[model samples]
Target: MTTTHQERPLAVLVGVQLPGVDDVEHAADLAELGRLVQTLGFDVIATVSQRRGALAAAAVLGEGKLKELAELTGGSGVVPSGAPERKNKARARRAAESGEDDEDDALGGDDDEGDADGAGSRGARRATVVAVDHDISPSQARNLERATGAQVLDRAGVIIEIFHRHARSREAKLEVEIARLNYVAPRLRETGGGGDRQRGGIGGKGAGESALELDRRKIRDRIAELKQELAAIQREQSTRRALRQGQRRVALVGYTNAGKSSLMRALTGSEVLVADKLFATLDTTVRALHPEVRPRILISDTVGFIKKLPHDLVASFRSTLDEALEASLLLYVADASDPTFRDQLGVTRSVLSEIGASEVPSRLLLNKVDRLSEDERDALRLEFPEATLLSAKIPADVAALRESLIAHFEASMVEAELLLPYAKQSLIGEIYENARVLSEEYGDDGGRLAVRAHPAALDRLRSLLAR
Candidate 1:
């Protein structure tokens, strides 16, 4: 089961630590970026980072750091300005001398010293992708690609690609497609022979569009079509949501890989896809809370959030995230074992605020506490006294969380008494279904019920009784 570099594309992570950014935060961002790259199936061999007042306009990294980054990828570390043919010839000669014919090998430099950190040796595989931990401009990406002689992807690009791969539902697929197209639209570059224009107009007399323009147009058209399809799917989703208006819903929202899905499965007893990779769960999954209490509660797991989550993805996944916006309560789950859990929690809150879910009632859930030491758990309790600190893997912890959920909804419930006539005895079953029946008595006339439930549910029960 030996895996070669070719089996998993090698990647070198690059990050620029801008002013006003904490050192630890910047390091965490790069680490998270590495995870994101890994989620895209790339093997991260090395990381390159530098503290700068701002990212370099041309390549997002300084000359020295860029060169250091290039060493890992066997690149020249200089963007070509002109005479591309000469550089291509030199690269080709190097490939021929090395007995390599792959396009990746063609990008290697004359230096065979291998990776900067000695991870790779002479004639060993080099990184073929450079993943930058920021949203770089199109020109910046182009310059970086030329300097490193490897494919470059910025933070947004990486996240979009993960979503594009993980999307499962029809709505999620449509949303990811739209976001991917939007991201690709700006970075579309003219390939070889792309300068030629397509003929159009009467008698084909005029040049209509270049290849790049045609590709951009096609992307734009596809995005529009995807949007229409997404809207249709959203309408259907709305209908489903409307049907559940009377049911209490709790949405699990948190940072990616934060054990939200684990908690989801624990609470709902549903077989949700839980993975350690970032963005592993893109589609929203809903199921009834298990153990089936009266006035059943429904739990939904949403797509996770991350620092600098792309705007296009936020917009695209709005319908899916609306599960949180429309939920009766939100469980803000965080991996308490993670040292950066506080910062991750902030990211989750910021994204929820962006979507107007800030006003929703939420409870902080410090999950994965099983991995925390006793002292660490005590410290967390002192820091977040209001949060429920528990692990999704523990049955007792899950039962406590379930009870907490039930209590949260119960606090808002209204107690009501309903009387059913003999002629409407069939409605008694509906009453028991929609409300928590504290007492029921069968009288000669029919039945009398004492129940507690949401006001809306009570109203519906009354209307059914009246009918």
Candidate 2:
């Protein structure tokens, strides 16, 4: 019963190409899992994929490959040099993957799997493993781990681990805890408490404390406490949002790790951590965009969106995402570098619609344009005529984005001609500093004042005229 995992576990990332899934979809699946393994401190040595026209219920990938992986034991629980003899032959097959292959194997008992390289040579054996496709059920993981003799992790666990690492704020940490607890609850049941055997009680108790029940109870209590604490934080967040009412707020929303924080930092000159990892940011950060015209345009850069984003995590972040909903504008950022940008766009759009933020006037921000050439940028300009394409790393691109935002003001802003009395001419000064006054001409009745303002502020000015 080994508790520690091998230092360099040989990994094979799996993705099954099923019907209705495009090639890029499957590629993203593989790429995301690779990133997840990196976060979990696992070395991905190889990849194993299959195009399953239909799933095989008995063994997910098919019986033949399942049996092959089963026999290898993924180099687990045994060392190659001390192995009995049969297990050493596969060394040549995986030579390319063994970057630092010392003769020493990480696992114990070389005799467990085999010995020598078929000619009685000696070296400890290492573990070659498999991380299977997204949506692998708990039963599926156990089945694969048993058949392949390799520990298993699905997409959700990978995502949860990334969230677990990135959550900085207390609220975010609790939200992640709640999601993790929920994720582990069903998994613990699926694995049957890791084959814990029941023991007889000294007092002749009818039922001893079962491992499964204890794990389940602990998860349930932790989830309850996390939820309670989250609720309290949500209350505080709600109040903070309420205090900023009436300002034209905009929220930058998009797929996870889609450079939202980078763009936010680029625009506001704020020190938001910009990382090259998925879900690098989990907390919401808001800043005022302009000091004049709009006076205060509160723009929030919240957590990035993701495909197959868990509903439980969504519900937990609803209070945080409410900031996006209350916003007057939505800035949808997309990774221009991703070949499947269209699909990513569709997924984010679906999430927005689900969150009830679909109706807001959203302008797409095609980010990472620095990765593209001039011709490529021009090509995308035609693809998204309405969106702004910019690279957060480039200051010039940030300036272009700012100019594009100001252009939005031109369409929504209203121009008004006002007749001000001589005594009320001082009121015009207030409007001059706060707004762009086009003209001032004295007429027979009074002085004329012409000004341009955004719709909301224009309506407020109209009300002031009545006074």
Winning model by TM-score: 1
**What is the alpha-carbon lDDT of model 1 when measured against the actual structure?**
0.84
- Model 1 regions lying over 4 Å from their true place: 1-6, 82-115, 201-207, 419-430, 439-448, 463-467
Query: Model 1: per-residue lDDT, tens digit, 285-307?
Result: 99999999889899999999999
Candidate 2 positional error at 430, Å: 14
Query: Each candidate: RMSD to true structure?
Result: 8.2, 10.4
Q: Model 2 TM-score?
A: 0.73
lDDT of 1 at 30: 82
lDDT of candidates 1 onward, in order: 0.84, 0.69
TM-score for predicted model 1 compared with the true structure = 0.87
